[model samples]
Target: MTEEDIATASGLPVYTWRRRHGADFRARVPVINPRERLRLYDAAQATAYIKGAPIPASPADDAAHPDDLLSDKEAGVVLGIDATTVRAYATTGYLPPGTERHGRTWWTRRSITVRRDSPDQRHHSPGRQPGDLRDRAPRHRRDPRVTEVSALLLLGQVTTDEIAEHYQVGRRTAQRLLAAALTVSED
Candidate 1:
């Protein structure tokens, strides 16, 4: 088996597996060629390593509600809210910033748990009128939501198509939102 083969079996990148477990793997697989670009593994030793080694944490674990990181949907589950709301909170910076990896968003479990225990700030009186003092703020107020979302896009957490679909806006609107957000952040 090659390093790629071991990586597939271990469910980790070749570099990462090598960096963390290379010495052990090499000691076990005495026949392996260390300098080879495509490192080959001895069958028995590689199989033993693959079977005995603990699998590394994966992005997929986010959706499964792991202890360290969470996807928007997983965060929703922890908070007992809808996934869309989680996404909105994350995109608007109401929730802690999320990490972008492979075009997916992942929030810290600690952040989500903290938010779940915090008070809801969006509550309003039932009889509030359109002319209420709260509503009197200028319409042109800098909406940080778009900017935050754009930052997420720039970070590669969310895609333009996702923004358009979730916001029910056009592709152009999504692009403009990202561009505007990036411009604001740069300043």
Candidate 2:
């Protein structure tokens, strides 16, 4: 089949498929036979094909008990804090110590659930209290790096960490700066 015929049959942009496969594309199209193509189209019409579907919990899949450790991200979601905050809490020894294995750290999912459910639990708490000590910071202590970095990025100049390093601050601080800047810009 001609290049035009191949493009029409495959429903791909002619230039892209041709550039990708080169001359071999022409030879393979006839070998695969257009029957498979038609079958694929029919399948597309009959059922939706989803990529990366979450595995359904089966009868054999037991609910993770309260003692099960979770990842920092999962714990953060349960505690309603950002992933960075969760990491910070872990670093500060606020959260129950997690175990490192397979190059990853995991918290007990059970421990998280218990902390979340307990009235006396104190780790990974979200939201600033009314009497938060951070409120005592002077107005001059406010960092403007996130704003500058985000503005520069929007203008296609610098990246997130570039701005952070420029100000000698952590990347998370830079990100928070950007988020705050975006919020203000949106308002």
Q: Provide the RMSD of all predictions against the true structure, rounded to 1 decimal.
A: 23.4, 24.3
| Model 1 lDDT tens row, 1-187 | 6666777788899799889887887766654444434455555567777788543332232353334556677688889989899888776667866887435677888888887888875444245777788767667766656867866756777777887888888999888876777777677
The Cα local distance difference test for each model comes to 0.70, 0.57
lDDT of 2 by residue, 142-186 (tens): 456546655765777555687678777798876777777676557
Best by lDDT: 1
Candidate 1 residue 119 Cα shift, in angstroms, is 1.9
Model 1 earns a TM-score of 0.36
Indicate which candidate wins on TM-score.
1
TM-score of each: 0.36, 0.32
lDDT of 2: 0.57
Off by over 4 Å in 1: 1-67, 123-187
Please give the TM-score that candidate 2 achieves against the real structure: 0.32
